[model samples]
Target: MRIHKRDKARRRMLALLLAGVLAVTGASVLTVAAFAGQRQPPAQPAATRMGTVACGDVGSLLDQVPAAAQPAVDRDLADLDVQVADAYRSLMAPGAGGGEQRVMDALVAKRTTTLRNLKASAGPDAGLPGDLTGLASCGIRRDLVVDASARDYAPDAQAGSSGSSGPSGPAALSKGSGNRGSGLGRGFVDIRTVSPNVAKPARTGSATGTFTSQCGRNENRHLNPDNVIVAPGVSNGAHHMHDYVGNLITDAFSANNRLARAGTTCSNGDQSAYYWPVLRLLNGVTEKDAKAPGGGQDSNVGRILQPADVQITYNSAAGNKVQPMTRFLRIITGDAKALTNGPANAHASWSCTGFENRQLADKYPICPNGSRVVRTLKFPDCWDGKNIDSANHRTHTAFSQANGSCPKNFRAIPQLVERVAYDVPTGVRFAVDSFPEQLHNPVTDHGDFINVMNRNLLDQMVSCINEGRRCG
Candidate 1:
């Protein structure tokens, strides 16, 4: 009976040992499953996922993954991280959806395709941990900000003028007005009446009879009941006014007459008249002969001129060079206050120094003989006949004469004034005193006339270039 009891005890001990071993094995299996599940969490929120994915933390996460699944898991996590980063960057990037956006999107798409192919080949078991995905999210945000900033601070693009001042600011004298006394004053001599004879006869007689023979010897005498001649009678040549001054006088007279008829005083005199025609010309009224309707001439005349067609000519003994002028135009079709400043008043002075430096480098690389030439002319220097210097230099000179100064700089060139003459059959001739204080030399304290002219020329050239016209 004792032997039987020992056998039973031994069997009982064996059973208890087996139960302990089974319990340990079950716990081990549960632990492994839990670790495996946690390592490969489902896609989480971008912010939270990235926070958990520390760099170089993949090894610890992979410890729970089976040996065979390890490679697949790693590849999947890497791809997911890359895709998440790419997605975030795309949405946050500046100008992301505009024209530039497409370029970046293409790059992201190519990378995504590559990653997707890698994941497909690696299989589903090869997935990345949540931490890796989170890191990718962080990287995406960083890249997006960097790309956006780069695009935002890029260089200023050359955009055509957006309602900025441009050539065609003011109206110019019309071509038709060349002969007619249209804008102001007693209209110029009738071309029909004055063309046949250069001079008007003192007394009314047969067309061929001499004035002295037809009338009494007295300088001022009545030849017949109907005819009287004044000594030094008006001649077509004398009556004709072609120069700018003459045209100005005629315009002033016309303006004054209109004002008088309207019961208003045209008290502004020659200055007012001179500018009036210019303003009219700029308004695209090419026919100087066409009168403003209803005698509203003076009121219409005072409006600011905007030049559409500008002609700039330089004439000297050497030859003549002319450039089509363009005014910096500001359209005032919508509002009358737009007419306040004329082209002359609104001109901007380009820096002479900058122009000189650029031009010299471009054109005068070598002297006429191909020898290297050194640039001696400096900024603020004016032509003083024999030398170029800032001091003791003359400013304004006639187009025919250089005031003894060499043409080393653009400021020294003379601008000629052309006006329509009423006395002459042909329309235009030169004018006296068309040269204003603005055109005179600095010694005379006449303001910077040369600078003004140069600026005007440069502005015209720039406008032409902008308009896609050949400046040459």
Candidate 2:
């Protein structure tokens, strides 16, 4: 009878685990092929600045933006798209239309309107917000937050829908040999070269806990619209969507004060929220693109792709005892700028299942016949010994060294490593859904966290980590 009761408990937990996957499926993207009649406008010479603020000044402007101002940030992108679409239509319409200069003037006016909207929404509390001139030029620069429907018309817009035919087979390979890595090289170096000596966790405690959620499950709640590290504020939750499998509510509004009171999927009652950018197939179309004015892109387009496995591990970094994860503590695992600026402070990377030999930097790997693609994100495990957050949201903690040891002046905390894999065919090219300037660079891939776990539940995780036991 005792054995029977124990088996019942295990079964119950399993049921709860499966029940946690949120329902997320089908995405859209806009393909230029869908454009009927009107030819694409001729390229105009670059403007001095993109929006009201020059691109060079965009970084500083982002500093003053606030998390509460995401709604306004989203509006700015929406307004820009509306203007671009209208202008393009007018230029291409079968009638007397504005010449290139007219288009340029229209772009300038639209940019000014967007800048004014940002300042008004930021309000006096944030003080004069940063200039938004770059939004027009860098329409797809990875950080701008935009609505799903509007994304189809966004810059570097690839054409395709999720259910439609994606980009045809692997990118045409260079002449000579037929094998992996034979295509025109785009700055891809094997990742194993840099991570060969890295340390794996010491052990899985009996109580090491885990929570699983289906990828592409909840588009509405998971995607992070802007750069988490750069634009901490202006948390516009648009542009890209994500899959979540923990605390129910996660958004610009997420806060420690009320998170504990929210609902959760963790059977143990964990309220922590885990999320990252949604992965899309390289067909040139996505769920978001499908909803555009024209039927979504049907040719190879970008759309959110589901992961074969979504594993969330809460384990010890000390390789000894598990440390308690502080309440409301925030952690950012990968460098968001790696794609555009190179891997200066980046910790995220992509590798193949069997070709573990090559851990790549910014570009996605061209896998062999049967190997699969994997995205590995390792979070910092060293805490400042105090403080749940820092002004930058990153300085409060540090990453464990290659040996898995925290630096001095910091304490070890449970480290989280998220591994997402996809069944991308042998050679079909794939790229992260980022800004047009990035060319789908993989370096932009990243993840974010806000510890809303109940205090009691956090203690339980701590016990499991410290006890050197894995729990689920």
Candidate 3:
């Protein structure tokens, strides 16, 4: 009876355990079926899909992509290259009133198309690499150009027309002093008359004897005794001679002065004009900086000038007002000597003594010791306080202010200056001699100059990147 009871209990327990296992398995299957029945998020649209890749995300995507998909990747890259080139060409094209809209529009449109194509190629299931996505999100759009008629892209309608005659060859008047003689006029010369009766008879003339006169005999008087006219003086010569001789010198000097002034004004204006475009580029990068701190600022900062507030402040300051001239000289010469170092000097520590005193002691009594206040201050230190290194007061004056004197080897490159002013991040050291040679003739096509410059910069950047250098 005991054996029978034990066997029965064992059998019942075994059956219960098997039933429990079966029940759990059934439940899991049902749960999985329910999940399967519900729709998953619809796969990203094929048109918009980036194949799960992002900008600058090309490396990883390139890795995992099968050999079959390599062709597609290559096609996409080719398309991007073409679009970018087109955008650049459009930008270089002349626009209404020579405004920036056309170029900007082309860049933006090309950027959009490239992005769209990239997305389409990257399907919902496309396994894109992480780095590529970050790059894609960089907001580097090709549609930088816009219609000249567009209100936003259009230059200020109220602003006065640019006095510049657009890009042109060297001024005709700038040739040389010798050219002035042939092309314009020589140093003043006077016309004189010799009395036939007093003058020696010409060999071919009918005059009889060697005629002479008391007036003609006085060589000093005949030659206009008062050659150096300190004030209005009488010249006993033909009125035409006096008028032509006297006025010629005065007119030539006056014209030369005018031309010099115009040239200087034009050069200054060109430098300042570039500030606008550079500001735009910096502003865009700043937006990116706001989104991703400490990412591109180092590279981009090299291209941008200090902000307006900083510039204004520097100008307003008594000691620093002259700094811009010095800074300009330094840039041209690449010499530190042109830059100065003194308390009152724009590049010196004393310039900021006033601002520092006001901010640290007067304004913020409650701030804790060693606390960093990040308020924006105009003319913070001559140019823009941000560019200057407050900590390194000894060397390296801020970008806003002058540093040491101009270097001994300071050589000027006008094109490089223009590039810097324009915030072109590439091609600072291109060969200027080659510019004219490669372009055939610079007088007719200025666009070629710009193209060659850009290409040179692009090549440099590529080379740097290939060498494992950081290329913002």
lDDT values of the candidates?
0.21, 0.47, 0.20
User: Backbone collision count in every prediction?
Assistant: 48, 60, 42
Model 1 reaches what TM-score against the true structure?
0.17
Q: For residue 178, what is the lDDT in candidate 2?
A: 18
Mind giving the per-residue lDDT tens digits that candidate 3 earns over 1-472?
Answer: 0000113443354333223212322111111111113322222222221110002213112212332443344455444433333433332334422322333334344545554555455443333333232222211111112223321211111111111111321111111122112211111000111111112212221211110001111112111111111111222100111111101122112232232232111111221101111122222333333221111211112122222221101111111112222211111111111000001111111011112231110011111223222112211212221221111111112223233122222211111111111112221110000010011011111100001112333344334322333322
Native-to-model Cα distance after best TM-score fit, residue 308 in candidate 1, in Å = 5.0
Poorest lDDT segment (10 consecutive residues) of candidate 3? 429-438
Better of 2 and 3 by TM-score: 2
Order of candidate numbers by TM-score, starting with the best: 2, 3, 1
Error of 2 at 401 (Å): 4.3
lDDT of 2 at 296: 24
Please write out the lDDT profile of model 2 over residues 92-182, one tens digit for every residue: 3333232544554555556677767766765553323254333333221212212223232222222111111123311111111212354
- Between candidates 1 and 2, name the one with more favorable TM-score: 2
lDDT of 2 at 195: 36
The deviation in Å at residue 17 for candidate 3 is 60
Q: Where is model 2 more than 4 Å wrong at Cα?
A: 1-238, 255-258, 284-288, 291-301, 318-322, 385-387, 401-409
